[model samples]
Every structure is written in structure tokens, then in C-alpha cells.
Target: MRMILMGLGVVGRSFLRTLIEKSPELRLKYGLNPTLVAVADSSSAVQDERGLDPKEILDLKVRKGSLSGHAREVGMRGVELIRGVDAEVLIDVTPSNFKTGEPSLSYIKAALNTGKHVITASKGPFALEMPALIEMFQESGLHLLFSGTVGGGVPFVRFVRKCLIGERVLAIKGVLNGTTNYILTRMEAGLSFESALREAPGTGLR
Candidate 1:
């Protein structure tokens, strides 16, 4: 599947790394070959419909700190990139902006309008405009996935939607933030709050 990935932050970089490492397994086991057609950060983007190198993209981000240095760099905003890319799916790992549902929200809308399925890790759009976004995707006959929004990769939304079935859910309780959960776990292991907070960064929780 051809895809466009937005956001080059920690989550985005880690996701690209994992995709590179697991591509072979993914193809062999699931018959899924994900090819990145474009990748964008806050300030810049790179596009290659034939397929962009995931490793090279990571290297560019690390060495230059932005995708602008790439030879295939494109001059376009996030929404424009979403609409212009000829991709089947859009993986939006952009940062959340609960106050406005940003650029991610706009990017998602453009993808849906252009008939691209969306898989987003950002939560702001869903939190603020779940009804409208859900309606948009449903009407477009495309999938709008957000499994990573609520509880990272735990599939909380999937569990609730599939496992619950007709069962009534009385209440829900859990730590949605991984960093905070890590600190709490450390505290349970007898570390002070401050010490746990200090140790969280080393574990790459955030």
C-alpha cells in the first residue's frame, strides 16, 4: 500500500523504524507491503510516488533535523500534501492539539475527501470532532482508524468495539499516557515520585 506519513517526532520516527524492521515479516505473514510515498514534518516534506526509502528518510531527519534537505522535497502544506499524494492510506502521527485539532484534523479531512483511508495516532481531532469525522469517513466508504490515540498500541478502541458486543460498559479506568504510567509503575517499585519522573526519559516513555 502506498502511504503518506505526517509528523517526524519521536513517535513518527519510531514508527518508521519499526516499519522498516518489520516490513519483511509483514509481507511474508500478512501479505502487506507498505510503501511510503511521502513523509512530512512540521516545516517540510518529501515525495516520491515510486516509493521513498524509509531508512534514508530516517537518516535525513537525524542528520539534517528536517526533510527539507531531501532531494525530493516538495513545497506544500500538510493538507495540500495529503490531497496531492496518490496514496491508498495516510498514517498521521502528528502531535495532538486538543485546543484546535490542527493541521492533523485538516490533513485527515483532505485525505478523506480525496478517498484515502486514514490511520492516525493524534487524539485532538477525535476528541473534538469525533461525530463529524466519523460521519465523513463512513460516508466516504473508507476506514478511519485511531487505535493508537487512546492507549498507544493497546487496541483499547478495538477491544471496546469488538469484545464488548452487546455488553454494557459501566465504567472505564486506566492510564492513557505511557510516560505517566511508567512513572507510576516505578513509584510502585519503591522509587520516589521525583526519581520515577527522572527515570522516565531514559526509558523512552515519552
Candidate 2:
């Protein structure tokens, strides 16, 4: 699978590491030869028509902050770069901007316009521009998958959209804040909010 990665944060770095570790199994079992064609952050990107070295990129990213810090023969910024790549799939894992969806939204739209399938974890573009994106992807026979958008791996959207396809959705209400829920759970165990927060590893959905 020829793919372009749009972000190199915690999730992106982990994805790269896991992809490298599982490449052999992926090819042997699933007959999928995954290749990292391009990698980008908010600043700049590195592209190789054949494939970029994932380890090298990851190491550079770890040493030097953003992708632009890496010494490169080629690089580009903004949505124009998305259109320049020749890849079958564009992985959009950039940070979500529920309010604006700026670069990520533009990147997804531009990639889809170029006939590349989009697989996004960002909820901003998908939540705000779903109608338009779905229309465009459907028209072009490409996918706009947002499997990791909400509630972590809870499958909340799938359960509502797929499992309850025929049923009507009247109201959606629940404790969406994992941090608050965790704190509340700890509070029940006689710990205060601040104590719970300090005890917890990191703030979630805050």
C-alpha cells in the first residue's frame, strides 16, 4: 500500500514504529506491501516517489523537532503538497481543529480530488465537512474513513450509524469526558479531583 502520512506526533510516530515492526507479517499474511511514500508535520514534509525511510524519518523527527528540521532534497507546505503526491492512500492523522479544520480539511479534500483514498483519524474535517467529503469520495469511488475519531476505540459512530442504520437517533447523551469520568470514579474511592488528576497518567478528553 502506497501511503502518505500527514502528521508525526505521538500517534504518527507510534504508527510508523508499529508498521515497521509488522511489515513482514502484514505482507506474508495479508499480501499487503505497505510503503511510506511521504511524511509530514505542521511545518514541512518529505516525499519520495518510491518510499521514504520510516526509521530514518522517525529518528530525525525524534532528534529534530518537526519534519522540516530534517535535511531534505525535497519538501513542500500546505495543500498543494497533498496534490503533488502520487499515492493510492492518504493517511490524515493531523491534529483535529473542530472549529476551523484548516490545513487538515484542505489536505483531505485535495487528496480526494486527486483520486486518492483518505483514511483520517482527525475529527475536525470529518465532523464539520462530512456531507461534502462523503459526496466527493462517493462520487470518485474513494474512501473517507474516520475510524478513530471519537471515544477512542469505542466504535461510537459505527454503532450509531451502522448498527442502528434503520433506527432513528433521538438524543445522544453520555459522559464523553474520560478524564472527568476517571476523576469521578476516583472520587467515589475517596480521592479529590486534583488528587485523581495527579494520580492519572494524563488528561483525557479534557
Best prediction by lDDT: 1
Candidate 1: clashing pairs of residues:
none
For residues 1-206, could you state the per-residue lDDT of candidate 2 as single tens digits?
89989888867888889888999999999999999888888777888888888899988888887676555535576577678878899888777788998768998888877888888778788768889888988888888877677665366777887899999889988776455677789999999888898876543233
Provide the lowest-lDDT 10-residue window in model 2.
197-206
TM-score of each: 0.90, 0.80
Query: Candidate 1's residue-wise lDDT over 1-206, tens digit each?
Result: 99999998888899899999999999999999999999999899999989999999999898988988789999976998889889999999888888999988998999988999999988899989999999988988999999988765678889989999899999988787877888888899999999999888665454
Model 1, poorest ten-residue lDDT window? 197-206
Number of the top-ranking candidate, with TM-score as the measure: 1
The Cα RMSD in angstroms, rounded to one decimal, for candidate 1 relative to the true structure is 2.2
